[model samples]
Target: MNQQHPSMEVMCHVHNCKFNENDYCFAPKLEVNPLQGSGASNSKEALCTTFQPR
Candidate 1:
């Protein structure tokens, strides 16, 4: 059976991101993308696409 994850509040710690508001992610949505050719093999290979430099 398929299961869906529940939505929860997002917390942000990146001070340079434009969406960061009071240590929280103020973006309406967030997306994580792979930065490698064959997809992310590890956490280091992924990027927060919602980041906008302040």
Candidate 2:
């Protein structure tokens, strides 16, 4: 499959993640979302909503 935004660089720092490589994600696509309840106090309120285990 082709990456949705191959030219766009999305960095990842979660070393334990399977799709992470050198602080970047290797998935064909990525989806980021805010955690439920709708109020975000900080970056921690957000989530990598599309991350999947290897």
Candidate 3:
């Protein structure tokens, strides 16, 4: 299938990130993971640190 944004890429470093050298995210889909504590209080509602937008 064709993607809407060809330049868009997503990655996930929460536990086991699946990003390669080509900046491609191999995750089947994006999911939300609940955070614990105040470390990421100032961040967005959801975190996708592994995401790399082209």
For residue 39, give model 3's deviation from the true position in Å. Answer: 12
Highest-lDDT candidate: 1
Each prediction's number of clashing residue pairs = 0, 1, 1
Angstrom error of the Cα, residue 12, model 3: value is 5.8
**lDDT per residue (tens digit) for residues 1-54 in model 1:** 899765878888999999998998988789989996759889899989999999
Ranking of models by TM-score: 1, 2, 3
How much does each candidate deviate from the true structure in C-alpha RMSD? 3.4, 4.5, 8.2
Q: Per-candidate TM vs. native?
A: 0.71, 0.65, 0.30
Clashes (candidate 3): 1
Model 1 TM-score, 2 decimals = 0.71
lDDT of 2 at 21: 84
Let me know the TM-score candidate 2 reaches against the reference structure: 0.65
**lDDT value, residue 42 of candidate 2:** 86
Question: Weakest 10 consecutive residues, lDDT, candidate 2?
Answer: 2-11
Best by TM-score: 1
Candidate 3 lDDT tens digits, 1-54: 977744447543333344443444675555444365535555564565444453
Global lDDT of model 2:
0.79
List candidate 2 segments past 4 Å from native.
Answer: 1-6, 38-41
